[model samples]
Target: MKLIFEKSVPGRCCALLPACDVPVRPLESRFARKDPPRLPELSEVDLSRHYTALAGRVHGVNDGFYPLGSCTMKYNPALHEELAALPGFAGVHPLQPQHTVQGCLEVLARAEALLCEVTGMEQMTFQPAAGAHGELTGLLLIKAYHRDRGDAARTKIIVPDSAHGTNPASASMAGFEVVNIPSAPDGCVDLEALRAAVGPDTAGLMLTNPNTLGLFDRNILQITRIVHEAGGLNYYDGANLNAVMGVARPGDMGFDVVHLNLHKTFSTPHGGGGPGSGAVGAGALLAPFLPAPRAAAAGGGYAFETPPKSIGTVKAFYGNFLVVVRALAYILTLGGDGLSEASENAVLNANYLKALLAPYAPPACAGVCMHEFVVTLERLKKETGVTALDVAKAMLDCGIHPPTMYFPLIVHEALMFEPTETESKETLDWAAAQITGILRRAAEDPQSLHAAPCTTPVGRPDEVAAARAPKLRYRFDTL
Candidate 1:
């Protein structure tokens, strides 16, 4: 595919501008720039065709089955998008007077209330923009709570070894030393290790209920209890909340602070570095320290109110508002029972996929997985020199997006799969077949697997160079 700039014609224009109807001010005087911006020049038809071609090359949930684990690349409901796009919701400015944006405030309040009911948290702040942002906000809340009580020694945050990479990163960002406790043989938090890790210096424990490996900790209650017993708060990372939405509540499990990924679990189009809302919910203990401008019911309408001891605005305004709007629409559409059923189906679909892949890529942990499961290709690499990356690349030839590769850090050659509730049984069966065929190729013809993804426009890109020395912007010299 040619770069848009390479297709540029020197004198071509895509659109015509009406002759200036008012006195024109020089843009150069307002904003300083050394040279005119170099943008592609093309006819409208040429530009349209260029973008259409690019669109065909891109793949998404709408394109086909997306089983990216932990990320939850499930099919989002179209109705949610339609509702969020409503002019009243989409056009309302964050800086608009609270009285004028009653409808917007209502959306926020209603969304917060629904999320509170689902997670069993007392209060919620839609201030954090993404899951990691929410983690940071939750940590700040914990810090404020502890500091207000004159508990200055609390400085360390305990995280499980199988936890998301963001868990430790968020803790460290919040100025808390991270203490990693290894997972037990059963792929759950090691009870004794957790007990030993928490002490006077422990500020909190950051955990994902169904961990990155997709194993739900049976000792979740005891895990939170141990942390609380040692005077540390428990922070729930809602990355895997798709498995237990409406089935379980983190607040009931003794967590003091919880952050939910509205983009992941809720019906929001996410991924590819996009708009995510990680609304933080808290128990009564940390409610006072929540982000400012919290939505509250005032008389018949809704209004924004700051908590008495607010953290003073984690975000400039209320969080990715449209994302929250979409999430609210999703919750309203599903209702309570439908949400539970969605979670159940998500778990069932994952287990079914795991069963099919067990022959080639054995699961990292034994027994039932939640909405996602991790499979290891270590044996395949040893036997056929076909690593997980080879398998992932081969998936493109099958016209399917690959599962998350080499993640959770603990598992070797990890390929995490999450076949969300949206996929049908037939789709799951087809994906299983494709994966099985890829594994067969791995064993029978390893060299062919190395030269994988022949069907894609770019075959086997230099991934290491792409990551380490990215060529993000197009340059005339490169072409």
Candidate 2:
């Protein structure tokens, strides 16, 4: 469990250099650094074992149940990775000529078309690098569309209290004043509140259908209609689209803009700070304002085209190419029916797991949940001093990654769980059992739950102190 640098041996070095194939050029004086960086020195075997041990400590979908709630931690197919690793997709340089990268362009074009068909959008741009990035891109599109028509007065965006934290942040980042609305008694948008909130300055309403509460709003159409009727637009947050995928279309629901999390609904998840794609899709209303150089069908082959009044480049180039490659392969492999089935299974898994845990910890809302559910330990905390954080820490000892803790900010002591379609019934059963055991421990020995997770290499950390005074590196006095 030592740090990589701690294991460094001064005399050791990895055998990496090959004999000079040609002439070796020395660096000029101005271009060279006076002292070399202090990097770990180790033999090949030493480096291999260090990383292998680190890998073993990590938890992922392949390791065990990963019901991460709003973040759908579904299992990706091996085939998607294989396809992305192909030479034509992986080897092509971003600056390659149009004719030379036909196959790559085709991947973009085909994915755009299929995704548009799924979301009921007219066009898409793989420019945004992540979901929040896509949210900004989509917001810019809405802002441009309104400004183009001399409707500069529309400078506000409405967001529900149950929305992802990024929704209001994205709106604010896009220079729109965010108007917050409260959720109704049933965890859906409060219609009356939304009705009163829209006005001359209303740019749009940013919402996630089957929202962060894990409930589909039956009033979605009416909600979107209200924004359109008010001379504003509706922006769909596709972070939770896995709950409805082929079951419904956001465009048909009257939304004009949507930012899809390719990592969430699509197979190429960018967990742990991975490279990701958050392709934005728009209806005809905002299509012309989309980011530039999207794959377009050009005569016999494909070509890149910028929209008439494009918002310009969002990223340096077309989004994480390998991520897009993996996503396209996932969609093609699943097809229409398979995608629909995947959504259905996702819903089923969530509901099934919710039922098992309902006896121990009541859910935040009543009735059916879509692809995820939130359970509150408020009552347990009040009765036994065992908060959601204690229960989550207890889960680590059970060898399970705990559900999202204290999220959505609506419910007190909230723990959200999303057992995606990829999980089996047995896995769900075991996770429920582990959680139930934790609940029993909370009731029987409240003090013990406070010091839970006794088995991990590292125990609970002082997160607030760590954030404020972070120990950023190893203490090497004389490197």
Candidate 3:
């Protein structure tokens, strides 16, 4: 494809402006430019066609099956986009008087209510911008709660070894020392190790139920009880909440604080550092420390009200109101029953793939998984010297996005797959078949696996050079 600038005509214009009506200052006195700005000069038709072609080259959930594990790239309803784009919802200003934007506040309030109902929490604060940001905010709330109760010495947070990296990073950012507890052979938190880790200095334990390996911690109730007995809180990282949405509630599990990724669980468009909403919910104990200004009933309408001791503003305004609107639409579309069915289907699809791939590459543990599953390529690596990276590259040639590789940091040759609820049974079967074929091919012809993605617009580059000497901006000279 030609660069847009390369198609530029010297004097072409997309629009014609009328003569300036206001008195204008002399150019020498008012402006400091020696030459006019250089911009693309293409016809409207030319510009439209160029962008349309570019959009077609991109891959998304709408394009095909996206089985990127731990990322839950599920299909979003088109109604969400249509509803979020409505002028009344999208055109409102954050600083508008509360009375003027009652409808917007009502939408936010309803979102909070729905989140509270879904997660089984007392209150929610839609202040964090993303999942990590929500983690930070939730940790800060924990810090404040401890300090207020005169437990300043409780400054240690325990995280499992298989947890997402953000858990420890967020804990560290909140001024707590992070202690990693290893998972047992069964892929769940080691109860004995956890008991040893918890003490007077422990403030909380951050955990995901169906951990990154997609194995549910069956002892979650006992784990929460142990933490509480030690005078510590349990923080639920809702990254994998899609696995247990309607089946379980964090609050019922004795979690004091939780953060839900609206994009992942509620079907919102999220990628490339987002346009995401991560609403933090709190049990009654932590409710008083939620971020301000929380939505409250005022007269006959909703309005913002700050708690007595909040964590202050995590975002400039109500965080990502449009994203919240989209989430609300999704919730309304998928009532409680539909959401449960989605979770069940997600688990069913994952287990189906697990069964198909077990003979080829089984997980570290046994039994059924939750919403996603991980398979290792250790045998293929030992026999053919072809690694999981080679298999991932080979997937692109088969016209499918690769599953997440080398993740969870638990398995050696991990290929994490999450066929979300949106995928069909045929799609799941085809994906498993392709993966099996790739492994078989790798055994026969290892070199083909190493040199893969032969059918992309551009082949792979030298990864080291691409990272260290990145060409972020276009250069006319290079063209």
Candidate 4:
């Protein structure tokens, strides 16, 4: 394949425009550039075919089964896209007067309300743009809530060993000491250890129910109780909320702060960086510290209100408003019962796949899982010299995107899979069969797995060289 620029022909145009009808002013001499900009030139057909071919080569949830763990890469409903693209919704400006954009404001309010009802929180701030940003916003709220009460001494946040790396990083950015509590052998947080770790210095605990291991913390009630007993707040990392949506409420479980990844559990697109929304919800205790301006009802309509003691604008103009619109569309489409069914089916698919792969996996503590599960390849590595990386590469050959490998850090040779709710049983079975077949082949000819992914456009580059000599920016000199 050649670079798009390499195929460019001089003076070729993809589009034609009529002469300007309106009177135009001359450019300011100071603002004018001395040289013309370098750009690719191609015919309309050339440009169209090039991009269309590129699109075909990329795989997405719409293209196939994406069982990538932690990241909920599920099929986004096409209706949401259509709704988001509507001119009435899409043309509205963020800085437009409140009266001019009441419908858009109402969508944000409704989305916030739906999230509050689903998570059992009092109010929500849809200002955070991504999951990590949401964590920072939640932590800031915790800090503000404590500081407003003159409890500035609360400066430490307790995170678990198996937590997403963002948890600790967010805490650190908020000027809190991050204390890590280890997970027990059974993969739940070490209750006794957490109890000992908490004290007056503890600001809060960041936890994910149905943790990264895809195992729900059986001691959740007790865990929250322990944190609250020490006068510290509980922050729910709602990344895995899909496993327990209507069945459980983080606020009811004693979580003081929560952030829901709308793109994950709520049927929006994921991956490729994003246009993502991570709405932060808070219980009554933390509500006053939410970011402003919060959407409110006024004069038979909606308006923005900055609370007296708000953390103050975590994002510009109520975060990504378009993503919020998509989430609102999703919530309205699913309602309550449909959302519950999604959670149920997500758990069912995960457990079914776990059962299918159990015999081939490295030793795991016996039990039922939630929406995702980890299967270690330690034994396979020891027996056949093949590794988790090899298996992931082999999965590509079978036309399936690989599960996240070597994550959660605790599990050796981990292959974490989250099939999500949308995949059919036939697809799950095929994935399982492919994984099993790869393992069997590994036992016989380990070398074959070394040179895997022969079908892809590029196979097995020298990763270190690629990284060390990254071609980050385009250069005409190089061309």
What is the TM-score (0 to 1) of candidate 3? 0.94
The alpha-carbon lDDT assigned to residue 101 of candidate 1 equals: 98
Candidate with the larger TM-score of 3 and 4 = 4
* Model 1 worst lDDT window (10 residues): 25-34
lDDT of 2 by residue, 1-479 (tens): 88899999888997788989999898798999988888989999998999899988888777888788888889977787888889988899988999999998999999999999999999999989999999999999999999999998999999998888899999999999999999985569999999999998999999999888899999999999999999999999998999998999999999998988888899785557667788999999999999988899999999998899999998897988788888988998899998999999999999999999999999999999999999999999999999999999999888888899998788999999998999999998988998998898888999889998799878888899989988788879945
RMSD, model 3, all Cα superposed? 2.4
lDDT, candidate 4, 160-272, per-residue tens: 98899999999999999999999886568898999999999999999999888898888899999999999999999999999988889998888989998888988788746
**For candidate 1, what is the total of clashing residue pairs?**
0
Worst lDDT run of 10 residues, candidate 3, spans: 24-33
Cα RMSD (angstroms) for every candidate in the order listed = 1.8, 1.5, 2.4, 1.6
Residue-level lDDT of model 3, residues 21-106, one tens digit each, is 99976668456777777788988998899989888777778878888898888998889999999999888898998899999989
Q: In terms of TM-score, how similar is model 4 to the real structure? A: 0.96
Candidate 3 residue 431 C-alpha distance from true site, Å: 1.6
Model 2, residue pairs in steric clash? 69-418
Per-candidate TM equals 0.96, 0.97, 0.94, 0.96
lDDT per residue for candidate 1 within 1-479, as digits (tens), equals 89899999999995588878999877766577878788988999998899899888889899998898888888888888888889998887888887999988998999999999999999999989999999999999999999999999999999888888899999999999999999886568999899899999999999998888888888999999999999999999999999998899999989998999998999698856678999999999999999998999998888889899998887788989999989999899899998999999999999999998898789998999999999999999999999999999999999889999998788899999999999999999999999999999888899999999899988876789999988899987766
